[model samples]
Target chain A: MAADRNAGTEPVVDMQNVSIRYGTDPEVLSDIRLSLEKGSFHFLTGKSGAGKTSLLSMMYLALKPSSGTVTVFGTNIGFASRDAMALMRRRIGVVFQDFRLLEHLSAYDNVAVPLKVRGMKESEIEKRVRELLRWVELESSMNKICSTLSGGEKQRVAIARAVINRPEILLADEPTGNVDDDIAQKLMKLFVEMNRLGTTVVIATHSQELINQYNYPRIHLENKSLKVFPALRRLSNAE
Target chain B: MQNKIKLNHVSELPLKKDQANLFLEAVTAVMVFLFSIALAGYMLVDSMAKNWQNGISGTLTVQIMPLPGDTDSQEKSLRLNKVITFFENQPAVESVILISETQKERLMSPWLGQDVDISALPLPELLDVHLKQGADFDYEKAAQALKEIAPFASIDNHNVWLHRLLDLASSIQTLALSVLWMVLAVGVFSIFYAVCTSLGIHGQIIEILHIMGAKDDYIARQYARRGFLIGLISGAIGTAAALSAFWWLHHSAVYLSAGLLGSLDISSGGWLLLLSLPLWAALLSTATSYWAVRRTLRKIM
Candidate 1:
């Protein structure tokens, strides 16, 4: 992997003093200033009530900041219309914590949904979906409904669906939380490979061991502030 | 730019699964078609019956009773000629056509035996009279004038039976119209309920598709296309069933009306009316589905 550089250059996401609240309650995310440069890999770590999902949702254009500026792909996202937001969302892949696969559709159909929404032809869509399913090792389970899949299989399918369209920004929220250690490590390696292909990847999880083991740049949220662990980087480099 | 999106979405519609639901839809469509045919037939036949009765009412029959003195044929002839002339001069009369002996004999042949010689038997002179447009026939005045010409002459106006038949025909027609309206309302209600059930079952599927970047139009298209397919099927099935029923009724009615003048032969115009039932059913199903889908989507938003 390339050495860490200034996040301001070609930043894929830029947030300035962002605060989010749901209907005038206590602020969940407060005064959060963050930037992730193009093709960078970052891990978001926080407690269960630390609003990690809220922050990832904002990155994927699913929520709006209550007070602050949000810029994605150089566009002022805070004022973007719904249509514009929907169009922008197609370029961002999100792996929801719950593995939000449609239960009615098969694994293959679920993966092809994003591409189908973009009006891709059947031949191209089939080739792309088949390739992605094979990548996730769900090729044999293509005909099975999402409900029939195991936790690890479901998570892999969700990840495959999120990245099938080759999104510029990939957001995974507790993507491997429900999987075994072996599967989790395999999924982490898959994310690493994806990050190397010039696709910015952001994983939000509570697992410090996974973050420390990988030694990627980490952003920690505590007391309504974002902190980057520069010492963890040195530890990984020395080792 | 927005129109381009709308047009493109409309043109490249997705192909839905060919399942058993489609078969049920076709059957429903055909039933509707049959219902339409019956309604149209009733309306057309009822209208024709009214027109025929109206024409019959406007005509009057004059019967000259046979003279007791058979040898006084010249006097009877002179009296009938004078009575005809007097009626022609009357402002209420348009024109009078005196029935010749031969024509009267032909009219009586159906009721009486054909072998009977009309010349030997004493027969009354019958004259057909038509009233002028915008002129009311003064029955009292015309009767008084006819009595002066021949004391035995009697004027008969066919309004009593004509009025009664007209009332019967009008009542039948109104009843048919009421039945048709009932069928329409029932059809709409049934479709509405069915569509609501369909939407309820597919609610989660729709929401999932929406979150997966599908547009509202795309989701609505899936439902509308399904509805239209069902409508087509129902229309055909309903029509076929209605036709078969109508044919059976017509055959039975003809058999029952052996001595009656009118049978159950509906006119071409009436048949055209019956054919409209299928189309109506199809349209009702489609509209109901559209409304159901739209209403459900609104709740989600």
Candidate 2:
């Protein structure tokens, strides 16, 4: 709630000369420097193995950057303790590329996990979980076990789970990959609505058509480096 | 302070939640209960052996020889009243019970044929001597005293047979104790194995809970709670079943052991001790859970 909603503030995410690698392997991300402001919508486009997942992992604090200073919400990530990282995680929601829904829980319980972890009372959890399930159009399938659900359903459930706690920042990796184009458009619209409500949204996708349709900034990954393109300029030039 | 919030996050049990864990908990309880009952039974056996040994520790028997004359008149007519008085007056002998001819003939009834007239047949006079608890009796001194009254009289100490019986009882008790120890060790190891499995399966869930700001104690509490429930159910079932089996065997042994069975009744205290099995099982399960969670959590963070 303390996050800036008005214009003219430091970016929510600021990375300078940051590089990430898996163990001692060659750098998967190189010299990445970027700034993402509050309430901004951005799409990350890259081919497979172009470090898109690795970069998103860094932003979500799943993996620490191998070099340079990476700050999330003006706090240096590398210096943060485990408790701090968990608190920071609460502020950010991530939709994994694999749609990592816990297989043993029902769809409703899976979505309710983040809320439960925050110690929300049962009644409040029920109300919020029901609302989020409806948002994902999964209200009818709330009691179904995740293992029995279809791929698109799983992706929606994962999205519902990530955003259920009303995170200030949401990062989605290939959220629409398993769904049809129509569903992909709907998910994109949901992200836009969240952005309008002051959530900083970053979506990693290879669908340029979906990216082009939205009037949002783009950060494209090519040869392990990130390139940003202005959203308003591109839209105006197209018109 | 911030750790409290994290604790709340990690406190939830892994995805399948309480029901599935209940099944495993019940299993653990049963095993521990069985283990406890076996231990109590062993204890009971040991107590019985001690009681028997105390009853027979320092008693001695003496067999008197028949007079060298007419065998028909050598029985009750040759009343050795002087020898009996002398033995009773001895300081080493606390009390002496003179065996009557009828009683001596009755004692030998099992080995000898029936219809033997006590007035016609010559039989040895048997003396039962009870020694004072702290008094040390020399066999040579007692024998010499008895021989001066009548030649051909021998004192039987009865130590050899008593020693063999005591040794047999002690060995049985030791065997039962060894068995009880083995079962307890197996129970502990079984719980350890189950805890290891739980850690392996729920490692990620534990990690997520950690990242959610859950403290080590919070997560461990969840696991311990599950284990406690399981141990309770399993321990109760196993203990009840074992008791039933023991009851059946005990009843059947009454006819087989020729009235010695009633003397070795499983005491109420023994039953009370056995009833603690479920509690022991619960404690064991929870302890195992706590140890596993702490060790695993440390490795993760």
Q: How many pairs of residues collide in each model?
A: 21, 12
lDDT of candidate 1 over B186-295, digit per residue (tens)? 66666566655555666656544554556555666666676676776667677777788767766776654543335455668766656665565556666766776666
Model 2: fnat (fraction of native contacts): 0.14
Docking class of 2: incorrect
Q: Candidate 1: which stretches are off by over 4 Å?
A: A1-40, A49-86, A178-186, A216-231, A236-239, B1-38, B45-200, B248-280, B287-301
lDDT of each: 0.72, 0.73
Mark the 10 consecutive residues where model 1 chain B has the least summed lDDT: B1-10
Residue B101, candidate 1: Cα error in Å is: 12
Residue A163 accuracy (lDDT) in model 2: 85
**Residue range A103-172, candidate 2, lDDT tens digits:** 7678888787777766679779887888888878888888787899999999999988888877778899
